[model samples]
Target: MLVTGGTGGLGGAVTAAFIEAGWRTVVPVRKKTSAESRSGAVGRGPGSNRDPKATPAEGDAVYVSADLTDPASVDAAVAVAAGEPAAPLRAVVNLVGGYAASGLVHETPIEDFERMLSLNLRPTYLVTHAALPHLLAAGGAVVCVSSRAAVAPFAGAAGYVTAKAAVVAFANAVAVEYRQRGVRCNTVLPSVIDTPANREAQPDADHSRWVAPADIAKVIHFLCGDESAPTTGATIPVYGRA
Candidate 1:
């Protein structure tokens, strides 16, 4: 599994779910941490030319440095994920995105709208584009994270809604292009994910109505695994009563 945005709130849960399910996960991080950062962490199979990092402790997924928005960087990250024959890249979970609320479409600047589009979709496209060949070879799955607002739009976030809807559309395109060849693509629409950042952003809102990251993670894990082999081009709503 190659999980982009594995260090974020929902992404942390998604990454953990894959690791717990026994997948050899590869996570792309933009920067290195003192404890977790090391070169060639993803493809350390014996006799490999890549430098070997220290053996990761149990349950630790490999981390490779990458700037998700850059095509060259994304390709490098995908290379790391696909380098090991022992752990062929079988799944890709796209969680690298952000939410921005800058008034209505009329009030928002064109630059802001473009920024939202770039932030939400660029990384997803770049990573998926780079990994599609490996996924085709391995007969795997892709789970993209969209949002409920994509379908049910709210005020002050036209750009976000459009970008998220585009993510769903992109996933569907991938599903259509690859299903016969054995790669399945699906999108999960989450509503107000109950992460710390969200809680802090909307403290007065009823957090109980928000979906938990862990719950969404389970759905993503299932979508990428064999259990959802019959599912593709599906838009699953994890609204959690919100």
Candidate 2:
């Protein structure tokens, strides 16, 4: 498995969930870290934001260093996951995106607009492209983290919304094109996934009602597993108190 953006809040939770579920996850991280042992430190770091109202998974997790945006880094990681022919990659979960500028198109500079698209959209396409051969061979799955902002209009975030919308649409189209090859694809449109970034942005909001990363991880794991074989080209909404 190839998990992009494994250093973040949701990515860590997703890693834990997959490990607990016995799915050997290969997180393509960017930077190096000293905190390596998740089997012992499991649920220690960011589980502080766990959902009080939701059930959580249990298990250990592993990590690998790889950058998503850089093509060489992407290629190197994907090669290890799928091209190796040793540890075949049966799934790819794209969690590489983040919120962009929250301003009107005119107010948001071209650099910011392009940066948002670069940050949110390109990683998915590049990683997906690199992993296509392995996906085709293993009949793997791809789960993209889109947002409600992609479909439902949000104020002062035209660039962000448009980029996310493209991601959702891309997943659907990829799902259709690759379905015949036994590969599945789906998009998760999360309303407010509880993460450090979100908490920092909306400090006063009732985070108790916010959706946990593990919750999204469970949904993503399902989408990548055997149960969702017939669930390709679909968009799942994961709204919390919205």
Candidate 3:
């Protein structure tokens, strides 16, 4: 299994879940130091104070340095993950995306709109495009993260809304094109994930209603398991009462 954005809060949870489930998890980080730190600290909370150099538990995780937005970098990451003789690549979880709140559609610049698309969709497309052949060879599964804003849009984030919606569409397209080939693709929509970053961003908002990273990670892990083999092109909502 390969997880992009695995150094992040949610991604850390997902990577740990897969590793716990006995999958040889490979996480791609942008910097070597980031990868090194993450390899030793999978699933640690944002507030963790553990020594960064401490050795991780056996079979904790493997980290590779790659930029998802770069095609060559993505390919290199995939190659490293797939090269594992005992556990060839069988799953890809795309958590590499960003959120940007802009003015209303009329006030938003074209560049901002394009930037949103590039930020959210380009890495997804590039990584998936490069991994398709490996996934096809192994009959694998894919899980992508899309925002609730894609379907339940609010004001002042036209670019973000549009780009996230496009992500769902792209996942559906992949599902349709690869279903017969034993490859499944699905998207999970989350709303206000309860991460430290989010709490810092919305200090006054009620955190009780926000979804937890562990909760979403479990859902994603299930999607990649055999029980969900019958599921594909599904847009499952992971919103937590908000």
Which prediction has more favorable TM-score, 1 or 2?
1
Per-residue alpha-carbon lDDT of candidate 2 for residues 83-125, written as tens digits (9 for 90 to 100): 4354478999998887766688778888888887898999999
TM-score of each: 0.90, 0.86, 0.90
Once superposed on the true structure, which residue ranges of model 1 sit more than 4 Å away at CA? Answer: 34-59
lDDT tens digits by residue: candidate 1, 1-242: 89998878998888778766767778888776433634333432222242233333334677788888899999999998888777799999999998888898889999989888899999999999999999888899999999998899999988899999999999999999999999999999999899999899899999999999999999999998898999999999999989
The C-alpha stretches of model 3 lying farther than 4 A from their native spots are: 34-59
Q: CA lDDT, every prediction?
A: 0.86, 0.78, 0.86
List the pairs of residues colliding in candidate 3.
none
RMSD of each: 3.8, 6.2, 4.9
lDDT of 3 at 80: 80
lDDT computed for candidate 3: 0.86
> lDDT tens digits, residues 28-142, model 3?
8876644455545543222224333343353356777788888999999889878867677889999998988779899999999999999899989988898899999998899
Residue-level error in angstroms, candidate 3, position 34 = 5.1
Q: Which stretches of candidate 2 lie over 4 Å from their true place?
A: 37-62, 83-86
